[model samples]
Target: MSEYKFLTGLTSGFTPVIDAGFSLEDYRHIDLSVQNEILSQAQLDAPEAFQKYLDNFLLAQGGQIPWGGYNEHRGLYRRSGLFSAATEEDLIRNIHIGLDVWAPVGTGVLAVLDGRIHSFKDNNNFGDYGPTIILEHEFEAGKFYTLYGHLQRESLKDLQAGEKVKQGERIAALGDASENGNYAPHLHFQIIHDLQGKEGDYPGVANRKELEFYLSNCPDPNLLLKMN
Candidate 1:
């Protein structure tokens, strides 16, 4: 196989990092259901402070945070071991490796570039990414993979491994909370340079110690979507 194309010819604009020049206050009032979940779960009582932290974090990570008033605190829970007893395995599992774009159910999710369907499956479980799809793209000197999680069932109806997909194709649609493994509707976009012996499911998040490996394998997806 050719060294896969690292990055080229991707475009952005459909997804704005800051809600089309709207202020933080404006995002707060967008009336989306997921915003309520963010406010309640993330405890984002202070919008300005939260937004500042989110912006700074994304900038440092080489990606742009998506708009829509949802702030993703990657590695926070993993670092604190809030999900369970602080075990090495548990910690290694919670660090999120993808950029989650908060949006409503039924949102149209387009493919970032031309590629072949590498694999896909229905991952039904609590706190899991529901239905998912992974595409393998070949570029000039490199090959890469993109994973889309929490997608509606319709998205997977006719897709299959080795199927060809065009750039900007409507590969999948957003799933609702109930069908999306019990979380709010959102797109968990991830890039993987190496599958690392796993299939059907990849680490949507990781722990502190495993950060280096996950980050290296899963580069900032904004490189393709430019949705930030």
Candidate 2:
């Protein structure tokens, strides 16, 4: 099915990922580009450092979604060797495949649609999804999946594969540095048209070689969040 048709099916009563103090009016665009000023002045290697940057940005924007990350080529990942490739010939996966909703720790993460648990795992690494969950969804458009990464470890307790989760249901919570892949608190939301036989774990970044394929497979998540 077309991306527009799939997007239309995803827009519904999803729970807010941020605190009550925030709203659409408070949302601000973050620049992960090489020429970004705030990034130029800060170090993103440490989670606390990134948190400071997020705090300042939220204060400046009046506490809103620090939304931006789809296909963004960022230098922030340099802090972790996990993003490095053994051969220079292999394009480094710096382009983000998902839209990140930066918010505070413990923020409720709601399921965007009705689906069953597909898979989940604790991808513990320097730069990885600490606790991740993937849900399988089917609509008139087609069968697809929604992935939620950087979730609290406790969120995975008692969750079984194939368990049903209603739309707008609280499936997880935003995790902290100790649990969420050592990054700032945020929900990594991705749409996968095909898992390619994968389970709970999926590549959240793409390199130049496979950019075209991934870009088409994982459409912009803002199509569902609608938080432009």
Candidate 3:
């Protein structure tokens, strides 16, 4: 399917990451590029330092969500070995495929559309997705999926495969470092055109060589959130 059709219903639809009182006015776009001052100031390798950065950022901006990750080449990944390949020859996955909402731990995460639970798993490794959930949505164009990564462990409790999730329903909560792969609390939201038959997990970052394919498959999540 053409990439344009992948975001057909979602762009003109509702917000998916937060509960209420969320707006573009309440959002501060985050910069992870090498030129960004925020990255230079914060000690990203330390969880506490990163958390302090997030806390101060939100407090100063009065924003509920610090969003922006689609196709962004981030230097912050250097702090985590998980983003590195076993060998130097292999391209590293630093380009973010999803839009992340940095919020307090235990923040409620919602679904943007009606769908069923495609799969859920705890990818419990450092710099991994932690407790993740993939929801399958049936759109007129075709079947696609929405992935919610870095969620609280309790969010997946008693969740059955193929369980129905309605539009705007609470599906999960923001997880902390201990449960969310040791990063600051946030919801890693991505729209996947195809899962490639993978379940429970999919790549949230792309190698530079296959950048085009991953970029096309995972369009800017703001297309769904419409947060300006």
> Once superposed on the true structure, which residue ranges of model 2 sit more than 4 Å away at CA?
1-4, 12-22
Better of 2 and 3 by lDDT: 3
Q: Put down candidate 3 lDDT per residue, 46-140, tens digits, no spaces.
A: 77887777677778878667887788887767666778753553388778888888878888899978899999999998889999999998877
lDDT for 92 in candidate 2 is 74
Cα lDDT tens digits, model 2, 31-143, are: 76556766852567778887788788778776467887888877777666777553563477777889888888898888887899999999989799899999999888779
- lDDT agreement of model 3 with the native: 0.82
Per-structure clash totals for the candidates: 9, 0, 0
Q: TM-score, each model? A: 0.68, 0.91, 0.91
Ranking by lDDT: 3, 2, 1
Q: How many backbone clashes does candidate 3 have?
A: 0
Per-prediction CA RMSD (Å): 8.1, 2.3, 2.1
lDDT score of residue 75 within candidate 3 = 71
